[model samples]
Target: MSTIEAHDLAAGYGRVQILHDVSLRAAAGEVTCVFGPNGCGKSTLLKAMVGAIRPWSGTVTLDGEDITSLASHETLRRGVALMPQNGGIFPELTVIENLRMGGYILKSRKDLNERIEELLDEFPRLRERRGVNAGSLSGGEQMMVAIARALLLRPQFLLFDEPSAGLSPKLVGDVLKRAAALAERGVGVVMIEQNIREAMQVADRMYVLAAGRNRFEGTPADISDDRELMHLYLGIGKREEGTT
Candidate 1:
């Protein structure tokens, strides 16, 4: 099975460091969720993994092949793609135009058109709104476009940076479900999310970061069942007293 692994990764913006010895593993057909307090370096981790930012120390591998510090476009060519925060859509571009940009790596125009149609069929609402500007769509629709754009390359692994941000509760669930669906279709999904409750519903595994370091790594049940982790890191309410 295909996999992406980051080990002992440390990165920063200029002199301010963010990630510290953070490690994660995501495999094909599974959803790995990363979450934590603001400034915990969750976004930085994604950027490093996708090559949007260079890792100061450590290694990022695709199926045991070192791919650390490769350029973002190079990473995409290696079958890993990132859907940046807010879906990373161009507001003025029509939905179809945004999808076309996603396929910029493709050399054949016919293949690009076919892939667009396939994706449009996969996302029926996008077919209906193909000509409309992406900025005017609802948050959920924009997210769909972003995800579709990332899919244009037929990536083996997809990374999402806070895909559910600023979305309604219903839309949050919808987007997470989409992530889960992608995993079901054999695309590895690594997502950074703040919507804990919604994220837990779709995540196959979870990792928590604090102060740019790993605090917890386990399944959703492991987190919910651990009172200490819940109380200290997650801030989830209703913990039983004196439970270990």
Candidate 2:
């Protein structure tokens, strides 16, 4: 298992800087949730960590080994996976074929097949629709397939960009639960999420972001005790009793 972390990370697209001195950690078997409003650099941090975009300054590490300069392919080879916001399923491909495509990095076909079997068991609906084209599935089901595909690599570090977006309430809970479960199974889980209630539900530690800089960070217990903080940033908890 690996611990993925960023130290004083400052990243952006070209000259448009977004993240500012962001330091966070996601350890194996714990969900470290990044909470923020839109345009606050939550996704930027992930892109930097996964090598999709190079960090202008600071460091990203896997087990303390610097990976900031690695390309996305090289980062994936190191057992790190990022589930994109747009579900990355080939709509024309059957569920099984789509999953096989995800395991392209695997050297052995048998190992890939075995891992697919394990995933199908965990996502039984996938087994039920193994031969169906991914395009035919609902939004929530497609998300499930995308997550299953990411698991094909057996990544030690998994990062997700709002896995619950566009999902129905039930599916939102289901997806977040599975994300937390991955952490429980020894995969370091880092998730950027706007759904505060559900995000906090599965979070072991929470980092609140505002304007691309860290605003607050602590365990869920620490956060739960701060009603003012919750109300201010996340629009949760009670506000003034007689005020609108």
Candidate 3:
């Protein structure tokens, strides 16, 4: 199976360490959700995995090959793409134009156009607003644009950073369902999320990060049943006695 594994990762910006001994594994056809409080190095972990920032130690392996040092573009070429937080889209650009930028690495216009059409079919809503400026769309629509753009390259693994941020509860579910749908289509998905309840609904496996380290890694059921874990990391209040 195709997998992206980060083992014993320790990385951060200049003179400040944000992650320490963090590890995670995401496999093709599964959704692995990572959760934690703010500044727990959730985004930093994704950055390190995709080479947005180099790890001070440890390795990021793609199907067993060490790709820790590869540049972001190089990793993208190797079928791993990171959709950064906040739906990275050009406010002034139309939906189709933003999508075109996603395929900038493709050498042939025919291939690019074909890929764009394929994604449009997956996200039919995007087709309806292809000519409209992305910033003018609703939060959910903008997320669809960002996701479609990421899929233009047909990556084997897609990493999402807080994909549900700045959206209504309904849109959070919508965006997370899209992430789960991508996994169903055989793409490895690693997502950083704040919506614990919703994320558990779609995640095949879960990893909880705290203080820049691995705190918990288990199936959704495992997390829900653990009172301490639910209360401490997932922000769920513990069930009281006789509350069956």
RMSD of each: 1.8, 2.1, 1.3
Score residue 9 of candidate 2 by CA lDDT.
Answer: 94
Query: Model 3 Cα displacement at 208 (Å)?
Result: 0.4
- Report lDDT (CA) for all predictions: 0.93, 0.89, 0.93
Candidates ranked, most accurate by TM-score first: 3, 1, 2
Give the Å shift of residue 70 in candidate 2.
0.8
Report how far residue 18 has shifted in candidate 2, in Å: 1.1
Candidate 3 on 1-244: residue-level lDDT in tens? 9999999999988999999999999999999999998999999999999999999999999999999999999999999999999979898999999999999889999999999999899889999999999999988899889989999999999999999999899889888888888899999999999989899999999999999999999999998888887888776866552485
Q: Give the poorly placed runs of model 2, Cα more than 4 Å off.
A: 240-244
The better candidate by lDDT, 1 or 2, is 1
Query: Model 2, range 50-95, lDDT digits (tens) per residue?
Result: 9998998999999999999999889999988888886678999999
The C-alpha TM-scores of every prediction are 0.96, 0.93, 0.96
Ranking by lDDT: 3, 1, 2
